[model samples]
Target: MSFEQFLFYFFSVVLVGAAVAMITVRNPVHAALFLVLAFFTSAAHWIMLEAEFLGILLVLVYVGAVMVLFLFVVMMLDINVARVREGFVRLLPVGLVVAVGMMVVMAMVVGARVFQVESPGRADGDYSNTKAIGELLYTEYVYPFEIAAVILLVAIIAAITLTLRRRPDSLYMDPAEQIKVQRKDRVRLIKMEAEKK
Candidate 1:
């Protein structure tokens, strides 16, 4: 087999293994780490397909930023593992069915060559996929792109709104309350008679 084919199979195996590990691992942090490995291998696959920009973006955006944020949140949050896994057995069959359906669809798409290219020739030396993508995005797909951005913004706002809660038991200092305080409010001078010690 060619070196390129060997590399493809090698990375594919790694990617699949990482993905499996990501889902099966009990520790969320370890799962996130496995996801990072999966992302790296996927990026390699993208680069092999001559989509260098997407490969780099997958690494930088997902692995570098998103995964790091995920890791931090996972580490910081007081997650109840037992509570989280309580529904796992109930959901297992549904999850497996969905997973199998997705695999079948993917296999069908690959076998049918649904995404076959019209021209398989290598791009010119001066050609830039980044520029082409930018032009297409800004020109033809701008509306959809803007809509996606707005949806993401709304999602972020919704997530923050959902997770934000005022805890009655937690103590918090209000800046306005702090600023309004006078010396008398904080301190009281006590007059006392001197006593012989």
Candidate 2:
């Protein structure tokens, strides 16, 4: 077979394997690492398809930032996987129904030939995908984009706040509590009598 076909099959196999391993792995960290491998393979496939910008963005954004963030959160949270899995069997039917429904919907949309398999849009001379995306984002989708950014900002702040819930004995200062501090009460001098040696 051709090099392109070989590469495609190789990446596709790795991607599928990583994805399956990601879901099936008992260790959360290992699952997350598997997910990263899946993401890398997906980016490779995108690059193979000549969508250079998307491939690079997928690597930079999802692999570099999001997946790392996910892994850190998974590791840091100390989630009890066994406890979490306790209800999986009970929820199996619901999960299966949702999965099947989604597959059906996807099949309908894809099988109906809605997404025409045309030559990649940038097949011609020097068609700038980044420029086109920038123009679209700035001109047509600017408001929605800004709103989404604000929503994501709020989500990040909320995640930080939730994870930072501290005991009264904890040292981390909350700005809201700090604002109530009084200058007169700030520091008290403790008098220590001199001990005769």
Candidate 3:
């Protein structure tokens, strides 16, 4: 097999293995770590497909930022392993059925001949996928792209609004006020007799 073919299979296996490990692992932290592995493997596959920008973005955004945050959250959360595992036996049959149904649907859709189009006649370094994607995004898909961005922004705002709490007893300072504060609030001067030896 060619080097590309070998890399394809290698990355595919790693991706699948990591995904399975992510689902099967009992520890949430381990599952998150496996998910990071899965993301890295998928990024490698993207790189193999010559999607340099997307591959790097996937690694930087998902693996670097998102997965690191997930890892920290998983580590900090007090999860009850036994309580989580308690429903596994009851849910296994339904889960298996859903999993198999999804697998069958995926096989049917993905194995179809519609996606088997002829490869574009271009040399390895002839064309830029990023440029093509950017052109399409800026031209034909600009409305949808902006809509997605707005939706994501709204979701972020909603999440923050839902989670933010105002503690009555906690002291809080406004940044503008703090920035404009005089040294009088920050420093206290007290006149006292000098300490005698």
Assess each prediction's global lDDT (C-alpha) against the native.
Answer: 0.92, 0.87, 0.90
Q: Which pairs, if any, clash in model 1?
A: none
Candidate 1 per-residue C-alpha lDDT over 75-96 given as tens digits, one digit per residue, 9 for 90 to 100: 9999999886887788889989
| Candidate 3: tens digits of C-alpha lDDT, residues 1-197 | 99999999999999999998888788898899999999899999888877888999999999999999998888888999999888888898998999999999999998999778776555867688888789989999999999999999999999999988999998988999879999998999999999999
Per-model root-mean-square deviation over C-alphas: 3.6, 4.5, 3.1
For lDDT, the strongest prediction is: 1
Q: Give each model a TM-score.
A: 0.78, 0.71, 0.81
Q: In model 3, where do residues sit more than 4 Å from their true spots?
A: 111-114, 124-126, 174-197
Off by over 4 Å in 2: 111-114, 117-125, 160-167, 172-197
Kindly state the number of residue pairs that clash in model 3: 0
Error of 2 at 50 (Å): 1.2
Whichever of 2 and 3 has more lDDT, that candidate is: 3
Q: What is the lDDT of residue 25 in candidate 3?
A: 83
Cα RMSD (Å) between model 3 and the true structure? 3.1
Q: Which stretches of candidate 1 lie over 4 Å from their true place?
A: 83-89, 108-114, 119-123, 167-197
- Among these predictions, the greatest TM-score belongs to 3
The lDDT of model 2 is: 0.87
Residue 107 local lDDT, model 2: 88
